[model samples]
Target: MKVKLMTALCFLLINSGMLNAQVKDQKMGELIDQQFKFADQQYKVLAKNLPADVMPKTYNATTDKVVTSNTAWWCSGFFPGSLFYIYEYTQDAEILAEAKRRLTILEKEKNNKGTHDLGFMMYCSFGNAYRLLHDPAYKDIIEASAASLSTRYHPAAKVIQSWNSSDRWVGPVIIDNMMNLELLSWVSDHDGDKKYKEIAVNHANSTIKNHYRPDYSAYHVLDYNMETGEVLKKVNWQGYADESAWSRGQAWGLYGFTMMYRFTKDKQYLDQAIHIANFMLNDPNMPADMIPYWDYDAPEIPNTYRDASAGAIMASALLELAQYSNKAESKKYLDASEKAIRTLASDTYRSKLGENGGFLLKHGVGFLGQNSEVDVPLTYGDYYFLEALHRYKEWYL
Candidate 1:
C-alpha cells in the first residue's frame, strides 16, 4: 500500500496541475483541511465494514441504519467516487485502497443496459480512477459502460431512456439523463466514435425542446413515445407536484449542460446551461443559506426538507460555470459556490464526530413524496460535497 501510494503521488506530480500548496482564502483552505480530516476518519470507520460485493447508498440516522446496493443500482458509484476525491486531496493510502476495492466490485456493471445510469455508476467511479491513476484498464471499463449506455438510446426519440416502462416512470427520459452524457462524450473522444457524441448531442437538443419551460426550470421526468418521437407527459417523479422544481433535478440539468458545453463547445448548450443557472440562482424561493429545499414549491416552504445533496451538486457545477462565463457573470456563480460550500462545511450540514451514521454531510432528501429516504445523509451528497471541495481548492485557490 505504501509503495503504491508513493508511486501514485509521483505520478500526480507529473501528470496534472491537480496538486497544490497555494492558499487563496486562508479560512476556507483551513476549513477544507478540517473537512477532509473528518472525512478521512469517518470513511475509515464507515467503509471498514462495507459489504464484500456492493456499495453504500446513504446513512440513515433515524434508524442508525446503513443501506447498501449492488453495482447495478444507479447510485452505486458515488461512494467510491467520493473516496477517490478525498484520496486525491489527502493522499490517504487506505482511502485509495477502499476506493479501488469498491471500483472492482462495481466493475461488473459495465454491461448493465437495464438502466441509463451506467454513466453515474461506472463513469463517476472509473472516470475518477482513470483520471487520477491513468490506468488503461479503467478506460476499457469506461468504453464498455458507454456501449451499454448507448443501447438505451432511441433513435426516433433522440434521447436516452432513463428507465424501462415502469408503473411509475413509463419509459420516461428524465432531466437526470443529462448527467449521463459525459461518458458518451468521453468514448467519442477516446475511441474516435462519432456515434457516441451524436447520441449525446441529440439527447441534449431534444431535452431542450421538450423538458424545459419558458423560465428554464425543468420537470423531473418527461415520458417519451419512442415510436413516434413524441412527448407524452412532463412531471416530477420525486418532487411535490408536476409543476415543482425538484432541487437535485435542476442541479443535474445545470451540471449536465455545462458539461455538454465543455465537450461539444456548442454555444447553444452553453446558453442553455447559463439560462438554467440564471433561473436557479435568482429564484425567489432560493434559501438564504444558498442550500435549496427539496422542492422549490413545497407547501411548507421554510419548513420543508432541505436537500444538501442538491446544494453540493449545484456548487460544484457553478464553480465550473464561473470559469466559462464572463467576469461579471462569473462572480454570481463563484460567490454562490463559495457561500454554498461554506454552509455545507458548517456544523449545520457537516456531521459531528462519528455521528449521522458515518456520513459526512447531512440533511439530504432522496424522495420525500414517496415517504422514503427523507432528510438523510446521501452517498451522492457526500460525493458532490467532496467534488465541490475539490473544485474550490483547485479553482479558487
Candidate 2:
C-alpha cells in the first residue's frame, strides 16, 4: 500500500510539472504576440514620421519630435534592424518595404572604414536582410562591410580601434567594439577567409585581457598604444566615473562574448560570458527587476535612471548564454532573462501605441555623463528588446 502511495505521488508531481510548463508556454506566447502586434503599430507611425534621407535615432518626448541621424551613425542599423525583427514576427509587407528602403541608403556605409561600428551599421541591417531574404546582393554588401571593418584592426594592439584618435586618448578600444565582431565572424564563415575570424579572435582576446576588472565586470574604454601594444589608460568616458561599472558597457561585453562563443565554439569565451553574466546579475546594485541603472555603481542609485537598453541587451545575451550553460546555470540565466523581458514589456518600459515616437521601449540612457539622450527611447533599446523577444520565442518557446 505504501509503494502504491509513492507511485501515485510521483505521477501527480509529474503531471503538475507538465501543467505548469504548459501554462508558462501559453503566457510567453501571448506576451510575444501582444508585444509584436503593438510593435508593428508603433513602427508604422514611426515610418510615417521618419524622414526619407535619414534614420530614426531617438524621440524627444519634450519636443514631441523624432530625431534623425545619418547613415554613419553607430545606431543607424538599429532602426532597420528593428523593422526586420517586426517583419519577421508580423510578416508585415510595409515593414519589409521600409527596411529595404533604409538598406539602400545604409549600403553606402559598406565602404566606410572610418568608424568601428560597421558591424552595427551594416551587419545588423544587411545581416538580417540576407538572413531573411537570402539575397545575394545583401551578402555582397556584408562582405564589403566586413572588409571595411577589417581596416580598423591594429595588429600590434590586437584590437579594433573603436574611435579615431581624440585629444584625450589615441587607439581607444571601447567595450562596444566587442559587439562589432559578429560582422567579421559572419564574413569568415561565408567568404572562406580565416583572416576576418583571426581578427575577431584577437580582438576578443585583447578585450578579455585589458577591458575587464578582476570581478569580470568590464570597463567602458581601454586606450592602447598601437605601436607598443600597451594599454595606456582604462577610462570610463560614458559612465559615472573612471572605475564605475557602466551598465550598457557590461551588457555589450556579455552579448559580444556570448556571440563570439556562438561563432567560434570557444569554451573560454563561453566561460567569460558566464562570468560577466554572473557579475551583472549578482551585483548588489542590480535592481530587483533586472533593469539596471545607467551605471551599476552610479552614485544616486535609487534616483538614477534605469537603462532599458542595458536590460534588453542583457536579456538577449542571457537567453543565448543559457543554451551553453549547465542545467542549474541555464535555469538561472533563463529566469533572469524572463524577469527582464516581463519588466521591459510592462507599461513602465514598453511605450504605449502611437507614443514614444514609434519606439518600442523607453528610458534608455545614452551618454548620460554628456547630458545627451538621457531617459529617452533609443533605437538600439528597441532593437535589442525585440531581439530578446525573438530569442525567447525561437529558443525557449
lDDT of each: 0.86, 0.90
Name the 10 consecutive residues with the lowest summed lDDT in model 1. Answer: 15-24
- CA lDDT for candidate 1: 0.86
Candidate 2 local Cα displacement, residue 163, angstroms: 0.7
lDDT tens digits by residue: candidate 1, 223-278: 98898888888899898899988899999999999999999999998999899999
RMSD of each: 9.4, 10.2
Full-model lDDT, candidate 2: 0.90
Q: Write the per-residue lDDT of candidate 2 for residues 228-344, one digit (tens) a residue.
A: 799999989999999899999999999999999999999999999999999999999998778898899988766567788999999999999999999999999999999888878
lDDT of 1 at 246: 88
True-vs-predicted CA distance for residue 79, candidate 2, Å: 0.9
